[model samples]
Target: MLATIERVLILDRAEEISKMVLQSEIAEEYFRCIYKVKNNLETQRKIREFIKVKEQYEEVQRFGKYHPDYRVVMIKVRELKREMDLDEHVAKFRIAENELQSLLDEISVIIGHSVSEQIKVPTGNPFFDSSSNCGGGCGSGGSCGCSA
Candidate 1:
């Protein structure tokens, strides 16, 4: 019973700390950027189009390299992605998201290392290698093979 109470207290304190971090100036800016993109009709339309094109690209890929339309589909997908990246709102949102992710990753690494040390495990390469490996559900389409 006492252990359960202690666990609840720890969880409550962790949630409080998380709330504090979210209320920080940088976090506020991140949220503002995300909200701006989310609320913009134009951005939403472009994102929808981008998702459609990405899905088409994936479908083409499943046809394998021998498919006659594979090359054409690939080219089209690249062009669509380029146009999406050029959108001011999308680009800004991506930048803000990356910044927020970096902060979270740093926090995760610190905690991971601390836990690893406590368990007598080596803390080499704290985070999983995100390069050349599909971290899964990348949402970027398979254009970047990291999610492949």
Candidate 2:
């Protein structure tokens, strides 16, 4: 009971700190601004950076989820030496491993979907105005608009 309360307090403090950092006016405005890219390569570069950071954070969460599983697996392996039914222990261990594998696959799919969505740029969006054909001279920066 005491441990649970302590954990709850810690998490509450952490969330408060996160809200302060993320909800600042400057941070909100900066993230709201549309990013301008000179070319497809530049756009891709920016997208990659965003994806990398997201993936890193997800990886940390994945590691955290597995910590308890690691302990369970260790216990099961040690129990394999006991006089209990060997088949039952083996089956249980396999089940745990399968569960872990499934979790990893789900995480991969979520990250892939998130990254793909971020990279999908709508045509004619002002963020990439140069790349969109709006009856301009030469595409901006030799991209698609020639209005430079």
Best by lDDT: 1
Can you give the TM-score per candidate against the true fold?
0.68, 0.22
> For model 1, what is the C-alpha lDDT against the true structure?
0.70
User: In candidate 2, residue 135 scores what lDDT?
Assistant: 31
Separate clash counts for every candidate: 3, 7
- lDDT digits (tens) for residues 1-148 of candidate 2: 4679879996897688567645655444333332222233644454455555455545555676465455544444345333222334333444544444444444444444465633322322243323334332343675643323
Q: How does residue 13 of candidate 1 score in lDDT?
A: 76
Best of the candidates, TM-score? 1
> Model 2: runs farther than 4 Å from truth?
1-86, 117-148
Clashing pairs in 2: 137-146, 138-145, 138-146, 139-144, 139-145, 139-146, 140-145
